[model samples]
Target chain A: MARITREEVERIADLARLTLSAEEAQALTHDLDTMLEYVQALDGLDTQNVEPTAHPLPVATALRPDRARPSLAPEEAVGNAPEREGSAFTVPKVIEGVES
Target chain B: MAQRLGTLSELRAALDDGRTSASDVVAQALGRARELAPAFAATRGLRADRAAEEALQADQRRTARALRSVLDGIPLLLKDNLNHRGEPTTCASRILDGYVSPYDATAVERVKAAGGVVIGRTNMDEFAMGSSTENACDQPTRNPWDPTRVPGGSSGGSAAAVAAGIVPVALGSDTGGSVRQPASFCGVVGIKPTYGRVSRYGLVAFASSLDQVGVFSRTAADAAALLQVISGHDPLDSTSLDEPVPDYAAALDGDVAGLTIGLPREYFVEQGVDPDVLERVRDAVKELERAGAKTCEVSLPHTPYAVATYYLIAMAEASSNLARYDGVRYGHRATGAHDLQSMYSRTRSEGFGAEVKRRILLGTYVLSAGYYDAYYRKAQQARTLLRGDFEAAYRSCDLILTPTAPEVAFALGERSADPLQMYLSDIFTVSANLAGIPGISVPCGFARDLPVGLQLLGPALGESLLLRVADAYQRRTDWHTKTPPEAS
Candidate 1:
C-alpha cells in the first residue's frame, strides 16, 4: 500500500550511481508507482507455505572432482581486455565522482 | 526486391548447386540493404571483409563436392548483442562502443560451421531492455511495412532485415519476447528455442538464465534450418543440452491431426491485446482446425502477474550480469580518474542509456537490503505460479496459441514516451521466458496493412513438435511469405 515517493526514487538512483535529471526522477517516480501497484497483484495469492523456485531445471548439487583444470594464461585472459597495461587488466576509476 | 524470388530452400539449393556464389549473395544483400536502409535502418554492423572471406571459402566448397549442411553459403544477419569473433559486439551501448569480442558465440560458431556466412550484425534496444527500437542508442530501426512505424525490438533490426528480403534468415535473442515481438511486427517467422537448446556461450549476458538464442526468417522452414544448425551441446556453456538434434525441417511434414491447440481464455479478453490481431490469430486457429487439429479454450490462471515477475527476475539477473562492466579489467575507461568512485560513476552513468540505467537502479534496489525478501523473493514465488499456469494449459493441449504482440507496429514515437506502454507490448511474451519454453511467431495476417503474428508456444525441447505445427500452418497459409507493403 506504500506509494513510491520522489525521495525514494532519487535515493535509489543515487545508490545505482546514476545522476538523474529532475524530469527523469519525476518520471521514474510515477512509473515505479504504477509498476509497484501492478506488482502488488501477486500479494493476494495464497503462497504462505509454498517454497520459491530459483531455476526450472533439475540441477543437482554436483561438481567435477577437484582435479587441476587447465587454466587460461594471464595473457589469454587479458587478451580480450579493452584496456590492458603490462599483462594486467586496466580499468577506469568511478567512485571518486562523489565527494568524501 | 531484396533478392530473386527463391525461398530460403531455393537459395540454399542454388548455393549447393554452384549456380550462386556466397560472395555474390552477400554483395546482393549488402546492395539491397543500402537501397532499403532508409526504410528500416535495419543494420548496425556491416562486416564486408569477413563476409568476403566467408564467401570465398563457400565458393571453394561449391566448386568441390563438399556440402556442409542446409545452411551452406547462406548469408545471415545477427542481432548486435550476439558476440562475433573479430567484430565489435556493442549491444547498442555507448559503454561498449568499439568494444570487440575475441571469440564467437557457440551459436555463431555452429552457424558458420554449417556454412552460413555472417554478413552483418543488426541494431537492437540497448542491452535488449525495451520493447521498441526507439530505445536503441543509435538509430531506431524502421518497420519495412510502414516506413514511419517501428520494427519491434529489441530484435527489430533482425526482423526488418529479413522482412525487407535483405537476408533469408538472421539470428536473434529472446529474453522477454525480443525475437517473437519483432517477428510479428515484421511478418516473419521468429523462433525462440527452448532454453539451453542453443548454447548462449558469449552472448554478453542480458539476464543469463532467461536469455536464449532464437532465429528470424521469412518462413518456418528457414527458421527450422537455422535452429537445427545451432542446437547442440557445448562444453563451454554448462546449460547447453547434450540431446540429439531433431530433424526439425523433416518434422515440418508431420500432420497435425491429433494435436490439441490451447486458446488461453485470458490471452484473448480485456488484457489489452488488440482485437484485430486476436482475430487474425483466431483465423489461424481455425485453419489448424481445418488441418484436423482440435482446439480447446484453456486458462493460464496466473497470467496477469507475468510481466511483474518477469521484470523482477530479469532485472535481478541483469544487475548481476552488468556488474562485470565496471571500468576495470576491460571495456571503456574514463581517462580522468580522481578516485575509484568517480571512475565507476562516470563510466556507468556515461556508459548506459536511460532505460538501462532505470532497470539497473530498480534491480539494485530490489536486491538491496530490507527489500530483497519482499520484492525479489516474492516475485520469485510468483514466477513459480506463472510457470505452473503454462504447465496446466499444456495438460489439455499440444501447444498453446496467442497473438505474438498485442498489436502491429506503432509509429516511432507512439510508445517511446511511455516506458510502461512499451512494457505492455510484451504482455503476451514474458510468460514463455518465465517458463523457459520454446515459442514461435508465424505470420498469420495483417492489421491496418502492418503484419500480425500468431504465436505457438510449446513445451521445453518441443522444438520438433512446434515446428511441425508451424509448418502445417505455414503450408496452409501464404501469409508467411507476404512481404511488408512499404518494402515492395
Candidate 2:
C-alpha cells in the first residue's frame, strides 16, 4: 500500500466534492494512511477466482409500472430546497456561459 | 417506586382490561422520557402532542374492540435515520439540519398502521458512521447504567431509552453493530434481521448493502413483536426479499431442547476480548447447555478480516449514496458560493462532521483510479470468503453464539480520539451484516457491573430460529430484567 500524502488527500477530497482546510487535509492524510495500512491485510489473502458479493441476495433490479399514478407535486418535490423559482429548484447556473 | 411501564404484551393487556388508557400510557412514557432526557440525552425530537392524539385514537379503538395488532397503543422511539412524515430525519448530521421528511419510511408506516405511537426520534452517530454517539450533532447520549460512559451507538439513544425503561421498544438502523452493540452495552435486547427481511425504503442510507433497520427492546419477545411488525417486502425497496413473513412473536416459545448452538472459537477465545465478557458469555452457554441445548466449537477462520472488509465496502457505498446531498435540491446549503462547483464543495464541507468526511474521502480514494482493484474489489472478494465461512459453520449448528462486542462500554471520549480503535469495537457484530444474516444481542450477564450481550447469529431469513434461541436463553436468565439504577 502506498502512503497517503496531503496532496493525495486534497485530490480525493476534490473528487468527493468536499473542501478541506489545510489542517483537515494534513490530519486526514495521517488518518487515511493509517487506515490504508490496516486494510492492507487483505493483500496477503488470495482471492483468486472468487467473485465479489455486492448484494447478499441474488435479486434482479425491480421495475415498476411505466404508467404514472400519484407522485409528489412540484412544490412538494422542491419543498426542502434552499432556493427555488416558481415550482423548480434554483441552482447556481449549471451551464455558466448559457443564459436561460 | 412508580409502576414500571411494562413490555408490549403487558401494556396491551392493560389497555384491553381498561386498567390504563392509551392516553395515560403515552403520557407516562413522554413524562419519563422528559425526566431522563437531561441525564441521558436520549431523545432529539419528541412528538408529544401528536403522540397524545394517537393514543386517544388508540383508546377509542380499544373501546370499540378493534385493535390493529399487538403494537396498538405501544409508544416507541425511532432512530433519527428513519423518516417519519413532517419530522426531521437528521441521521444526526448537520447536512440534514432543517429537512422534514414528506413521507414515512415503510417501517414507520407499518408501525403506525399497527397502532404503535411514534413518541419521538432518538439520537445517533452522524450518518450512522461511529461506534459511539459522540459523533452526533446533538449532545452525546450517555449510558443509563453509568453516566460517564457512552451508550454504544449509532443507535445509542434508542438503546439508552430502552435501558432506562422510558419505552419498551424502539427502532434503530444497524449497518455494523449499531443496534446490537448498543443493546449489549445497555443491557437490552436488539435484533438485526436478515438484510432483506426488513424494508429499508425510507431509511437514510449509510452503507446500502450493510444497512438494515432493526429493533431494540427490553426482551427478545418484545423485539420479536416489533420485528414482525416491520419485517416484510416493500415494492419501494427493491432489495427487500419477497419471502413470506412469519409471526416472529408466535415462534418465541423458548424451547431450545435438542438444538445445536455453535460457539465460534474466534470470538470467544479471541485475543482482544475482555476476560470478564468472555467469562459471562461462556457461563450463559453453559446455562443454555443445562437447559438441553447442545453446544459445539466452530471456527470462522476469516473472522479477523471482517472489520477491514466491512469499512472498505461500507465506506464505498456511503460515498455513492451520500452524493445525493448536494446543495441544490434539499438539505443544508452553503452560503456565499458564486458558482455551482463551489456550492457543492462548500456545502458538503460545512455540513458533514469529521468522521463522515473522513469516510467519504477514504471511500473516494479507494474507488478512484488505480486503487479500485486493490482495495474495493479485494474487499468484496474477501467478503465472499467470509460469507462462505459462515455457511460452512452453520451447516453443523443451528445458530452461532458469540459476544456482541468485545468488551463493555467505555468512557464517552475514550476511543473517540482514535478512529481505528473505534472501528474495531464493532469487530464481533460486523460479520453478520457482511454475510446478510440475522443476529440478536441479548443481555446475558454483567461484566464489572455493566451489561454484556450474548450474540446469536442465524442464516439468511432465519429470524424465527434466532428469536427462539434468544427467547429461550432469556427465559432462563434475568439479566434483561435488571434495569439501570437511575431508571428504577
Candidate 3:
C-alpha cells in the first residue's frame, strides 16, 4: 500500500514552501496516501523498454535574430509589485545580517 | 435580446449586411453578461468601456469597407488565466490580488487585432486545478442549466458564459479536460487543439507540458471561426508549432462520408461510467453512421491508467511552473516576515486555497528525492504507452469518438470533499491531452435535464478533420442550438 505519514506530509509541505495547519496537514496526509495508492496502478503497465515522454509533441527551441527590442519598462514591470521602491521590487532580506 | 444573437458566422453576416451594428451587439451581450454574472458567477469582471471603444473602431472599419476578419466586431469572453493588458487577471485566486497584466497573451492580442471585443473575463478554478469551478477564491460558477449543479471546470465560467448565451464564443485553457468537460456539462462546443497549436505566451501556467489554449463556442463552426483567429506560431512561446493552420471553417463541408471512426472498447463499458451518457454518445455515433461515416471498434488498453498518469505529470509540472508566484516578484506578499522563507510560505498559504496547496504538496512529493523514479518517471513512461495507443489506433481510423465526461453535471458540493472522485471526472478527456491530440466536445443529448457531450479526438495537427466531423454531426443534430432556460 502506498502510504504517507504526517511527518512525510509536513516535510513535503516544507519543501514546497507551504504553511499548513495541523488539521490541514493530517487531512493532506490521508489524501496523499489515497492518491498515491491510486497512482500505483501504473505499476501494472509493462513499460520496460518504453521511453519517458516528457512532452506530448516534439519541441524545437525557437531562435530569433539578436536584435535590440524595446522591453517592458521598469515602471510598467513593477506596476503590479506589491512592494516596490522606485523601479525595483522590494523583498524580505535574504542574507543572515544585511542592512536595509 | 441576448438569446437573439446567433453563432459567430451569423453575427458576421449580420455585420456585413448592415443588419446590426457592432455597438448594438456588444452592448446587448454585455448587458446580458452584467445581468447574469451575479446569479451564475460566470464572469469575474466586464470590460464595458474597452469593449465600447473596440466596437466603435469596428463600426468605423465597416463604414470604410475594411473589415479585419469574420470575427471583426464580434464580442467574446476570455478566461481569467489569459493576460489582457491593463486588466486584472486573477484566475479566480487570491494570490494575484490587485495584479494588472502589463501585456496581452498572444491569443488575446490576435483577437484584438481581428477586432474581436473582449466582453469580460470568466471565473475559473484557481490556476485551472479542479474539475469543478467550486475551487475558486471567488464564488463558484453554477451551471446555467441547473443552478444547484456545477458547470464542469476549470474553464467552467467560460463554458457557462457561452452556454448562458451571453457570448457566442470564449477562450479557455485545457489541461486534462478543462475545456471539453465544462463544454460538455454546459451544452456548448469546446475544442482543445493540438498541444502546441495555440501560443501559450501570456497564459498563466498550471502545467506547462499539458497546458493548451482551447475555445468554447455555441457551435463547431463558431469554434472554427475563433480558433482560426487565435491559432498559429508565436516566437514568444517556443513550444507553439510552426505548421500552417488550415481553413477550419471551410473544411467543415458537412460531409462525413468515407470517414472511419474508432470507438475504444474500454471507454464504452458499463463500469464507472453513467450508462445514460454512454447511450447518448452511442446514439450520436449512430447518427453519424446514418450520415455515411463508417465505425469500427478499437482498443486503447492503456485508457484505464490515463487519469493517474495525467495527474502525476500535470501536478509535477504545476509545482514547477507555480514556483514563480513567490513573494518576491508580484502577486500577493505577506507582511511582517522576519525572513524570506516565512514570507513565501505565509504568502502562499494565505493566498492559495485548499486544492492548490494539496496538488503542490503531492507534486513536490512525487518530484522529490527517493521518489522520482517510482512516481514521476513511471508516469512519464506510462504517458508514452498511452500515446502509442493513440498512434496505433489512428492507423485504421480517421478519428476516435467517446463520451466527453463520465456523467452530467453533478450538484455543486457533490465531489468537492473528495479529490480522487473529482479527478475521475476527467477520465474520458485526459487521454487526448496526454497524447497531444485534438479533441472537441459537442452537445449530444440530455441526461437528467443536463447536457451530455460527445467527444471526437484526432491525431496531432488533425484539427481540420476533427472540426469537419464535428460540424457534420452538428448539422445533423439540433442539440447545439438548445440554450439553458436560465438565460431567458
Candidates, ranked, TM-score? 3, 2, 1
Superposed model 3: Cα runs more than 4 Å off: B1-4
Give candidate 2 regions above 4 Å deviation.
A97-100, B1-4
lDDT of 2 by residue, B1-488 (tens): 23457888788788778899989999999998998888999999899999999999998998888989999999999999999998988988889978999889999999999999999999999999988899997689999999999999999999999999888999999999999999999999999999989999999998999999999998888888999889999998999999999888889887899999998888977588999999999999999999899999999999989999999999999999999889888899999987899999999999999999999999999999999999999999999999999999999999999999999999989997799999999999999999999999999999888999999999999999999989888889899889888777
Candidate 1 lDDT tens digits, A1-100:
5477889888887777666778878887877777677777777877776667676554444345678777556776676666787788755443545654
Assess chain B of each prediction and give its TM-score. Answer: 0.97, 0.99, 0.99
* Global Cα lDDT for candidate 2: 0.92
How is the predicted docking of candidate 1 categorized under the CAPRI scheme?
acceptable
lDDT of 1 at B425: 91
Writing each residue's lDDT as its tens digit, candidate 1 over B232-344 gives: 97877877777789888888884999889999998888557788988898899899999999999999988888888888888888877887776775567666766666677
Docking class of 2: high
Tens digits of per-residue lDDT for model 2, A1-100: 5588888899889999999998998888989999999999999989999999998767888988898788778888889999998888897877878876
